[model samples]
Target: MSIKSALAKPFAKIIYKKVQKWANNPVDTQKKVFEELIAQGASTAFGQDHDFVSINNHSDFVKRVPVRDYEALKPYVERVVAGEPDVLWKGKPLYFAKTSGTTSGAKYIPLTKESMPNHVEAARNAILLYINETGNAKFVDGKMIFLQGSPELKEQNGIQLGRLSGIVAHYVPKYLQKNRMPSWETNCIDDWETKVDAVVEETLPENMTVISGIPSWVQMYFEKIQQKTGKAVGDVFKNFNLFIFGGVNYEPYRAKFENLIGRKVDSIELYPASEGFFAYQDKQNERGMLLLLNSGIFYEFIKADEFFTENPKRLTIKDVEVGVNYVMIISSNAGLWGYNLGDTIQFTSTKPYRVIVSGRIKHFISAFGEHVIGKEVEQAMQEATEGTDIRVSEFTVAPQITPEEGLPYHEWFIEFENEPQDFSALAKKLDNSLQKQNSYYYDLIVGKVLQPLKINSVKKGGFQAYMKSQGKLGGQNKIPRLSNDRKIVEGIPQ
Candidate 1:
């Protein structure tokens, strides 16, 4: 074996040991994480404001720190951004991860020195855990091509600001750096289309063993590689065996990827965001990701159905049940106290704690009280296209609420790479699949309260064009799948 592979084997063993310990006793791991975070930030302004010193357990902590969203935490974040020390965490943050916002223009999330390791470690351990579980460590001997955002971080009040992926790229492990691509110069390109071309030029001929990125961008890279080489991705990189993906659901794009690669390869899913790395797919036999209970974040869950109510029931890991969607609330070493992450997740297992991201709380459609979310829409789309030749490039759903439309109906704007023979049948199947998934939707259709779903076949590249128009074409930018209003649907071209 080469010197790098020889060194990595021992490190992999150590990480696997740690993963085994965490997996064996997740409840204890969670309690320890909660205590450590509270103790670490006990002297910060937020900690004092929330009575963090007096908090001894999960119940006490929850009672002291009320649930809050980004809007509620903006004041404290402003202080941190303005170079205030010990404002949120123990000291000033190393950088701020700037994420796209809805009502607000942008969200600047603090990334402290203490908390940065959690992000890096969680990601590293995810790969290590996979390696341990599958006995596939040879990939480390080759290069890893990570499709990330611009690495050119902007500074504000002495605090660096950039996309989370870009921020993390700066801290990639030294060992991996030797075999990582594309170059930092290529990654610093602000334009995604331009950046992808540069990345392809740099890494297309390298001995790439692993590829990691959002599905859409990676698909573009795969297409470019095929166009340049005139060969399948599998043929180009014979050793490429792993694809690590996050930022969006991979189900819709799985077939397209398989078609591009010409064969199936092992894959891993991660639940990382600007907020934190929450979970990773640890077991091939399991469906959901293993929740990172021991990470520097303490988690709470409020039932998604009750999140908008006057008083919602908040539950910890101890009380979270399988099969129920919950809005994730987190308190972390990064100084976010009871911050609502705005994402909904459903527990698939409780003993070792596994979860599946259901959807975004803000990205749901309930216009006629028949609530539907991203997961439901994605699943329905998958079901609708099953055994058919159709492939959805991108899609969004919106309520056509105006009476001038004759009947209230849900309109689906879909961009297809491979069009199905029967568009009407596809729409009917999607509607029927949704009805089966959501009882409220089923009741509405059965009572004739709502008309059948309408599918608007969007022109190719319409969604991409819409994203570009919004100035959010790549890297963590995704079209919200469901909306109560027509903002997203109206923006797309048929």
Candidate 2:
């Protein structure tokens, strides 16, 4: 191995060993790890705001900590960015990652020297575990193409830090430094006209291997390539390898990608949000993903219903039962101590720590008292349209409280692979599939909720057009596959 490889490989091995051992009880191991890290100034106890005196003691260490969301953290993050040793933690933040919020405007997440390691370790473990399983250490035969956000740093107080994209780019291994697509000074916030063409042109001549990014941007590039070259992306790229995507699911866009590229694309589910990296696709099916427990986080799971409450029942990884859906909470070294992200997850197994994301606790519309989740809707759509050209690209279901006929109705907007002969029959079949999957919806349809599922057809690239217009076309911004509001659902094209 070269000197660079020699240095990185041993450290990677040590981290991998710890991850392998912690997969069994990721929550407990993380709790202990975070406690030690807190004592080292890397983190803080969550209950320190109210029960600081008591939480500082040893006996109450493992008890649950009160959960908080990003809005509650605004003041503290502001102070950190302003170089003040704010509320709980002490340190001048080295950088702040900019992420969008539902209502708090935009969030400037502080990333100090003490906090950056968590992000790096999470990203590193993702690759290390992949290497251990596939035994493919040198997967990048040519340059590894990262379809990422603009590399330009937004400077605040003479310190350079803006987005996760800029921070990650700054920290890439020196050996692979030259392989980056967009140069550091390029204005990513500018229109796609300024950057996309050059990025495609530069990489075409090299030994391009793994292509990584959000599914939409990659699809955008694929489309752009087709327009420019007068040839499908498959013909242009002589040796296109693995297609690793994160941020969102590729199921809706997969067929078009494959049809044009003429290659089977292997995907890695990247469940990362502005908060942190959650889980990844299984490199080996049965083993699931070797979740990065030690990468700067202490984890906990709560019953989805327990979220948004002052007192919630939280479970450690050891207490996690198989085949049950739960909400995810974390205490990370990045200073989010005992934060509830509100995303829901399902445990596939416990021994090796395997899971599949079920839905979002906040992503439901029980306006008629029928509790419906994103996963149920997705599964129902998949089942209802089995073996039909009427595949849904994106969809949403929300309750309409005020109806002309005196009942609330569930509304849906569906994108298709091909036009259906009888869209009305397709709509009824979709309603049936939903009713079968969720008894709550079935009851609502019969008595309370509403009747006659309302359906609409969206034009191609309708979702993409909406996202681009919102200036949320890249980074953690994703086209929401499932939602629970008719107003939000109507925003997409028909």
Candidate 3:
């Protein structure tokens, strides 16, 4: 075996041991993590405001701290941005992860010394766990390319500010750094098109064995590589064996990716956010990712249906049931107290605690009370396009509430790489698939409350153009699959 593979084997073994232990007693481990966080931050302003000193258990913590979204937590975040010490965590944060927000134009999430390690360690452990479980260490013998945000972090009030992916790039382990592609200089290019061109030049000649990034951006890189080298990705990186991805659902893009790469490679999903690294796909056979219960974050789940209510029923891991969608609330060592990250998830398995991201809470189509979510739309699209001579590059669905010529209906703007033979039949199939997945949608259609869905073919690169306009074209930025309003639909070119 190569020296790199030999070194990775031992590390993977150790991580597997720890992961097995954590899985054995998840609830107790989580409780201990919560207590430690409370004890560590009890002296901070946020801690004192929430009465953390007297909080002795999960129930007490829940009673004391109310769940809040980004808007509600802005005051404390503002203090942190102003360089205030101990406003949330023990001291001023080392950095802030800049992310898009709903109410606010931008959000600056604190990343303290204590919380930063969680992101780094969890990411490392995820890869190690995958290697341990699959017995695949050859990939480590060669370089791995990660398409991420620009690493040129801007200093804001003495704290570094950048995308979470960029911040994490700064902390990649030294050993792995040697095998990581696209030099720091290339990664810092603010313009994605320029950065990708540089990455293609830097990595096309390397002995690359793994590729990791958001699926959309990675797909872009794959296309660029193929265009430049006149070869499929598999041919360019003959030993490539793994593809690590997150930020968006991979199902819809799976077929397109397979065609681009020329062969299927092993893949693992991660649920990482600016807030925390919540879960990772630990087992090859598992359908959902294992929630990181002891990863320095206390978690709570509120039913998605009741999330907008004044007092939604909050449930612990023990109380959550499989198949029910829940909005995840987290109290992390980063000093966020009961902060709702706004992504909805459903537990696929509750024993070892595994979950699939259902959708963003705000990115759903429920105009006529059908309550169609991200997962449902993804599944419908998959079913509708299956076994057809059609390939969709990207798509978004929105309610056309005020149609000039027809009844109110849901309209889908689809950018197809390979158009279907029959557009009318494809639209009918999509509507039928939606009815099968959502009972409420079917009822609405049957009762003549809503018209059949409409399909609008978008010009090639329309979605990309729309994303670029929003300044969200690359890493961690995804087109919302469904929207209640026509913002996304109207923005795309027909």
Candidate 4:
């Protein structure tokens, strides 16, 4: 190893040791650490003064300050980019992590140097936990493709540099930096089409072994690479052993990925956000991803259905119940307190603090009065095609409103792996599967008052090409899996 890497190896080891200690600790002990962090964050105006004092010491203190969204911090971001110190906090922002808010198109989240350690620690914990579970320390060896966002900073505009992916990139251990696929310029989150092409050209020769990215982007890239070479991407990177997918579930593209690669890749699910790297797949293969409790964030869960209710019950690490869906709220070292991130999850076990991703809180279609969550849709899709020779390459469901009907109807666009022997039978089975699985959907199916579910098949590679056209390539970004409005879903052609 180079001297620099040799030096970093030990430093990385030290960090990993600290993370391993945290990961293997009891849930109660981790909870205590998070509680202390929340208390510290709430009591102090951290970025404002660049000082960590109790909230009581701050002058503009309200008894109970309400949670503020990205709009509340826009002025601070503008000032920070203008070279003003202490614009949001006391010191210059180390970087801005770009996030997509429900209301905001793109948001620049500020991060300071002090909080940078948390990002590193969270990632380290994820890697170390993988090693502990699989006994593989060479995970970083060979080529590891990170489906990343645009790394370029917005100089003169509203959104600035220092995206979450970029901020994390700035802090990656030096040893791993050399192995990151795609050039820094091409790894950007924006400008997806060009970046996708750039990554394909650069990484093709590295003899990559691990592919890590959002499922949709990866699927798109796989298709794009295949189209360019007239051969499958897996055929090119035949040595690829593991697929580390995060930001979204790979269930939709699971079989297709395996087929494209011509091998069963060891898959790892990572739960990370612009705010924090929260959970990772450590054991039980694909069962439940373990929460990184000690990595600078405290987590709270409320009943998924009760989220908007006035009196919703919250569950801490100590109080989590298995098998029930709960909405996730996070308090991070980055200064977000009691934040309802709007994602839902289910606890599979409290003993190991393992949980499964249920769905997004707001990503439901409630027009029919039957609340259909991401989990239910995912399960229904899996069941509808189970044991069938046909495979769904890509799919999306949207609630459409027709002038003839007051209520909305579901429109499904699915691409099958092969020409169905009986297309009508397949469609009928899909409708029945959905109705039987989801109550709200069942009502629509039985009533027949709404338009019947429509399924359309497009030519292969159509979805990937469409995604590239929209500039949403790579990392943490994908076509919306579920949307209340049909326009956005329909926008994803084929």
Best by TM-score: 3
- Model 3 weakest lDDT span, ten residues long: 385-394
lDDT of 3 by residue, 1-494 (tens): 78878788788999888888978898898889888999988999999998988999888887898999999999999998998999889988898999988777999999989889989988888889988888789888799888998888899889999999999999988888899888988988888888899999999889999899988889889889988988889998899889998988888888888888899889989999999999999998889999998788989999999999988888888799999989999989898989999899999997789999999898899998999999998888898887776888888899988889767888989989888888889889999999998899999999988899988999988888888998888878889999999877878878
- The candidate that wins on lDDT is 3
* Cα lDDT tens digits for candidate 4, 188-285: 53666677778888987777878877787787678777877887666888778778877766776777787777677677788877766777876636
What RMSD does each model have against the real structure?
1.6, 3.6, 1.3, 4.7
* C-alpha TM-score for every candidate: 0.96, 0.86, 0.97, 0.82
TM-score of candidate 3 on Cα atoms, chains taken together: 0.97
- The order of the candidates by lDDT, greatest first, is 3, 1, 4, 2
After superposing candidate 1 on the true structure, give the runs of residues whose Cα lies further than 4 Å from its correct spot. Answer: 6-10, 403-406
lDDT of each: 0.87, 0.66, 0.89, 0.67
Model 1, range 1-494, lDDT digits (tens) per residue? 67766666677789878877877887788789888988988899988988888999987876788898999999999999998999889888999999987678899999988788989998888887777777778889899988888877999988999989999999987878888898988888889889888988998778899999989879889989999999999999999999999878888888778888989989999999888899998887798998988778888899999999986988878889999999999988788889999999999998678999999998899998988999999999988887777887888899988757567889998888898888889989999999999999999888888998988889988988888888988888888888889977777767
lDDT of 2 by residue, 358-417 (tens): 777888868766778877777767666667766455556666667677656777776665
Q: lDDT (0-100) at residue 130 of candidate 1?
A: 79
Q: What TM-score does model 4 achieve against the real structure?
A: 0.82
The segments of candidate 2 whose C-alpha lies over 4 angstroms from its true place after superposition are 1-18, 24-28, 41-53, 56-65, 185-189, 286-289, 308-310, 403-407, 446-448
lDDT for residue 195 in candidate 4, whole number 0-100: 73
